[model samples]
Target: MSTNKDTMPTALLLGATGAVGKALLKDVLQNGKYAQVVTIGRREATVDEGIPQDKLVQKVVDFENLNAHREAFRGVNDVFCCLGTTRADAGSAENFKRIDQGYVLESAKIIAEENPAPEGEQLSPVHFLYCSSANANKNALFLYPQSKGETEEGIRQTGFQRVSIFRPGFLEIETARSKPRWAEGLALSIFPPVNRFFNLHMSVPVTDVAKAMLTVAQKKENAAKGEEETTLTGSKAAVFSAKIIDELAARPLTQSSDEVLVVRNPYPEPRSFKVKTTAPKQYCVRPNAGRIEPNSKVEVHVILQPFKEEPPADFKCKDKFLVQTAIIKPEYESLSISEMWARVESEEKESIRQQKIKCVFQVPPEQIHHETKSEQSTLDNNNVVVNDVLSETPTATPVPVPLSPVPQRQQQQPAKQDLNDQLVRELNHAQDKITQLQKQLLVKNEQLERDENGFRARSQANGPSRKLPPTVQPQDAVHHHLAALETQRVTEGYPPQVVLIVAALVFVVTYLFF
Candidate 1:
């Protein structure tokens, strides 16, 4: 933990605002190896993690519109992606996928691609460590699992040169975070045994999970290794493969002298993490103590690694480790309209930030259209339409002219009226530009499609052309389409070339691993 700052590997923490991520931030920042630490979070935490205020990079992003943000990922060395949202919080399964699945994959893809080797003197590629769910599967029966699985698969396929996926279980809620829609405490008590028979699954403490992930990522090389290790790591990996998990659901560690057992939560208690460090010098710790709101309960239990080579039958604390997972729930089940308004308002801020690049390129184009398009504004007043049009305008052009100035004496009313008129003009000009760009994009796409049709017709006529790889045509189209989009976005100002390059890189990296 006392490593020098110069020795630290730069890590980008994507979900640093979360309880687990917050833990990682503390450990990573305090350890002193932190050459640099950057975070992309939904909202600003009231209390800053120890990282310098400037070091903490926050982005208000609509998990849904991740595609528009690939550029913002530039220069990130390693990415710690722990971004997630539940269906209840999101209001529907579809919304959950948009955040959990879509945001996760899109963020991974960009991180894999855009991360440049940290530069200054030395050169090293970026690392990617993701916090995935235990039951993640693209084709699972449940919505959450299915999205998580798909997200995992997508990340694996994306070419992040170095990627590590951490799948912690439901958790041993030991933090004090509040959630609006978590299962009621009574319901959790009534829930039946899960992961009991399953050799691979287990709930874990959030703090331990965070610490372990930080430990692995701090190694630097974890991301560089080409092979994908699809399991929990650090202390968790050790506990998942330990014997004590079966001996005691809540207690898993035994001291060297065999005198004491370390359990997370003692009997007859909920929302608390207890440590019974009896004999043999076992450590008594509430790992999640440094991480979350105090009200959260930790319910993690595990059946660890299968018995291997003949050694001691006794549970050994020295050989095993695990973490404390936190569960953050709000105070209510359903969001009131006002709450929804707040949620939407909060969600919109992120939507705007991500849309900045979108508008920069997507709107600037004459084809996207400056007029006759949707004059959309969010409830938060994000002028989606005008921004799009104005964004696309080539910087070469000055803004549309303003109206006559307000005269003195009638200053108050006239100035107000004048300001309103000027805004109208700006909005009009933006709309027109957007329309022009939209039309151009439409025409370009159509032309490309027609060219493909022509090529197909020719291939059909020649027969031999069909021998060319089917992948070739599509690949060409994709390349062409993507290139055009890139160029168009640049011209319109939706995406910078840096962003597109990063996106492509993510795809390549993920593809290699998958």
Candidate 2:
């Protein structure tokens, strides 16, 4: 349910500094529906995480003694409570409850008793959004689950009639900031892929969890005002349902697909009618150049499937692929889930490489992000900050723009707010790479210098004017980089170069036989 434009639901997000809470915050902010957001925690949050300061109501409070700030909960509606304390984090069992159970219950009491709205302006009934663990049963003896179960029960008892609970099975992802244990993340990733076979455990992505939370928050705020949403939807496989699971367990693989002699066509009299194997054909991705970096987006047009008598449902292809950061660089590459942009192309039709499609994906350097911040800060130093309508813009532009024209900042901003923090890290990494490459190259160059010093020294001193690698002797560096780039273009998606490389090896062996 979409909230009314003028009066979006105002939310009080407790446990606002947690992994799940931070995730929920990003999605909520991205959704852009909430009218106001107040994030509170045991302490004031810092810029240690790249979260911009403007968004949060950072507070450091003793949840054990929240009496001083009890009035703060006055008009808050849609309370998202992710507050918790691990045994280790709290130091003792009693300490843990004070944060997880005591802290939460106290907050609930304030929300229920402290109805803080101005005269004649009624506040929305608070909907408590909670995060819980699986197997959180009231009868459980384990301390963690027991306390969690108690918190869930406590919220139910609170007068805030509407309650929403999210008991994610196992949070299946990691943060860019921390090094989560490998085994936990591995189990989450590997188990979900074969859900039909594995019935015991399932996991949902953090994105999906955040999405569900936002969905229910919207429903409670905008739907039948007092409606309580108990509908659970995540990680339930079609085969896991008793009836469906039983049916699948009793059946054989033969039920899935049928093989028929797809009619030897009637129109031909050309002796032999060899049909192409309908095994979903082949796919390929050809990037225009070596690396798609920032400021430049590659144009990638899609190739249409053949008009041959309408293909079966299994054969139909759709353009669906995600841009993945290369293991080395975060530059985006287009990937089709069906395999590649060429999945439904001519190769599958017994036609040789005739389909070409084009679509554009943008790549910009990290500097662009760098210079914009400088521009904004420049406005401050130059007093570009304004008043009236739209406010003041900083008069001075700190970073210089080139006359020939290129994006201002050409750097990728580390999720951290300060540009200085990431510059050292990325620059250090770049320097390490440069040193390693140059070290090895130096040994080779030294031997050559012993043969001829003047020419090699001149090349090194001139820097970019150095001669090209012998393998690419004829082509200029720009053309060489472009050629090297093209050969590996869709390497992120398809197998054109790989197949050629493999074929080349085979051909070499065959020639030796001859």
Candidate 3:
């Protein structure tokens, strides 16, 4: 896509106090392309010395109540978000999630919905640029990356016209902070050297990240302007790796002349290439022609001549460098550089491959402080108007909106009430989950208590048996013998007594018979 050079857009910046955020603020102010730079934060940002404050409109608001500060977000064309916090800094995972995930997402929603276009202008697509971490995945086991991923996912769903997520690797923060981060410092000390030596895109300076973001936004804006030369590659929801960020942020340095270009051969056949530039007077290409073995790469040095006068601010050099490559053929194998190119141009045109890289100039950081008196006055007046509305009270809270699996913004009919209703429904759903968990816990506790009681009852019932020795009998088992006396009386005393009884009985029987 091509970008318009004439459009000067307003930009809304969040988290200006952070390392990358601070760098972004600096770059945005110095670029001089943004018509206005609105900053929203909890406290006043500590602007650096020499940074122009004219374009800056800082608002101190309650981030917790972002609704109250909706005006701060109005009329912005781009959003640069660097709002994030560590679990340790936030004091807990929940707090981290609230700040990293909740705040980031809610802010996106507020800006996307509440922010309206300037009067008399149609609402243009709002480009969202987020600073996310490398390896950020919603399904990640760790909280930090997971939260970042979730935040990125959520912001995409907020209906922004374009969503660019920058996943920078280990950041080397140069800005001063209240507390030092030992982990980052350690990594910065150990990883960068290895990263460079191996050409691993595992570490990047925070400033580079800021510049990369600006580059992307600039490219997108330029595309909007219909600049035929601008070729903004990537998806609507683009993900930039550290390497891509560095590449996009490439700019000529005033102090350095040497830059490296890497040419690689992906095919199994040997390849020959020649490098040429439109700015031959300003740049020198070393070993202008080279051959690369199959599956190998060669680094070419591009030396820039010192500028007699510094280029104008926001200057984009029209000069370009082109690399032409072709497979090595035996027919032109021994030909001189010019002859080989001539032969290839005439015969092997179909096999010739070309790539072009345009030259970009870095805007001086001090440009912000060097504005003309009248321009400075105009910016100051604008800042005054913007400052008049700054307040300490927080206003907007994210009214719940339906989240779609696809990257589509849900319709916000009657915006306010629908958001509130959706949020209430989500809250109710969460409450139901909590209630179900509580009931299950209660059931488990009751079952545990019943099991305990049954165990105790069984223990008590078998207590005596458990206490008795296995070999011992009870006292009821003892027996006694008492047969002797009864037997003697019946056998001896029965002679007289029994005979008298028998005779009496016989006489009675005879009398009765007669």
Candidate 4:
């Protein structure tokens, strides 16, 4: 499953409106890696923040009718099932099970069966990622944990090529609560400082769970690209514990940079690099041209001098200037690259910092239209006239009119005559063909009757004295013979009656016209 680098992946999201689900949706959109994000929920879904509408498709569907929307699962690369519910929210244990276990399992089953791997691929095309509780156990006495464990089993049994189950502890959501829980609030307040010291797998942030899921998906995708192995520590599915989840979430947004400057080599091989920039005219790169060894580091110094031109009143130069860098390879042309962002700011004194650019935004130009008016002056009969008189007076120049080659009447008369003549010829030809077919049919019918009668007479005369070979009865033979005659006549052309009627119509038309 080596995928094209330019091809963006598509993801299907369940429980998009939930806390972790919302965070996951934002990360998927903001990462700009997914080409399409399909969110399915019982009601219409909306993003809390703005995102690319082209990449997001919201499908409002009834969970009870999952089968009806089975086609939606086709061609999906990753399924993020964040659907969950509490017994209180669902009003009963049965309802909670229906949401947590039933819906999740059914969706996974459909996705596994519908989304098949590409031709010649061994693994299932879709990867299943489920969010389960840390305490989830199939034999657990509690219904909630039991339901979550059942869902985990159900997803694994669906036979997805790769499955990543996240068993996160209690999630801390910053948004307004739909239902207040005193125990969750007390834990959130007390667990942050002491949880790390005691190694307690208590509460975790909603965002960390979302980030962990994305990290797993990206890892699997990279594995498919042959950048890494599919198996993680001898297991196909990587189940992240609470501590692992926190570490992943706490990871730096980008590669660490030096206090003053930073440089990164995304390519596999070491290459010579140079830095260039436009505007401000104060930034300078020391030893701009240098070779960066493979899997190594390079430190460069950037000096910022005083600006020559005064800054605009509203200008914010924090992240304004474009820093262009290029890589020089032997026997190959130099290529410009902008994989990192550099910002020079005056904080008490001038300073420069660089970090990898995660996302790029391009603002389109605004559209506006301007209207123009033209005025013309005309002189009529030695008196000047403005726009008003120009409309009343005729122009001196004559306008030419197109003329037809023939008059309308004459053109139509010849066309009508030609049509009538063509019709007459067709009618005559048809009548002749029909008459010939009818005569042939009658001859064949007569011959068939005579043969039948002779055969019957012979059978009667022979009686029991001579035994004759088995043959069709006289009535059946006559019926078959007549059927053959009718088929031949129809295959030849129009029937006799049809030809006669057409001929009579043509005669009447000609008589009336002439």
Q: Backbone collision count in every prediction? A: 88, 40, 12, 0
TM-scores, all candidates, are: 0.41, 0.41, 0.45, 0.43
Cα error, residue 335 of model 2, in Å, equals: 32
The better-scoring model by TM-score among 1 and 3 is 3
Number of the predicted model whose TM-score against the real structure is largest = 3
Which digits, one per residue and each the tens of the lDDT, describe model 4 over residues 147-241?
Answer: 88778767766776677677676677868677787877888777665544543436667776677677667654223321111111101111122
Model 3, 22-124: lDDT tens per residue? 8899999999888789988887677779988897899998878888888777778889998988887999999999988888888888887776444564442
Which parts of model 2 have CA positions greater than 4 angstroms off?
1-6, 44-56, 116-124, 176-186, 189-201, 221-227, 231-233, 236-514
- Model 3 residue 418 CA deviation in Å: 56
TM-score of 2: 0.41
Superposing all C-alpha atoms, what RMSD in Å does each candidate have to the true structure? 35.4, 31.9, 29.1, 33.7
Which one wins on lDDT?
A: 3
Q: Candidate 1, which segments miss by more than 4 Å at Cα?
A: 1-7, 48-55, 62-71, 116-124, 180-201, 221-224, 233-238, 241-514
User: Which lDDT tens digits does candidate 2 get at residues 230-291?
Assistant: 32223432100000000100011112311111111111111111111122232122331122
lDDT (0 to 1) per candidate: 0.47, 0.47, 0.61, 0.55
The ten-residue window of minimal lDDT in model 2 covers: 239-248
Error of 3 at 466 (Å): 64
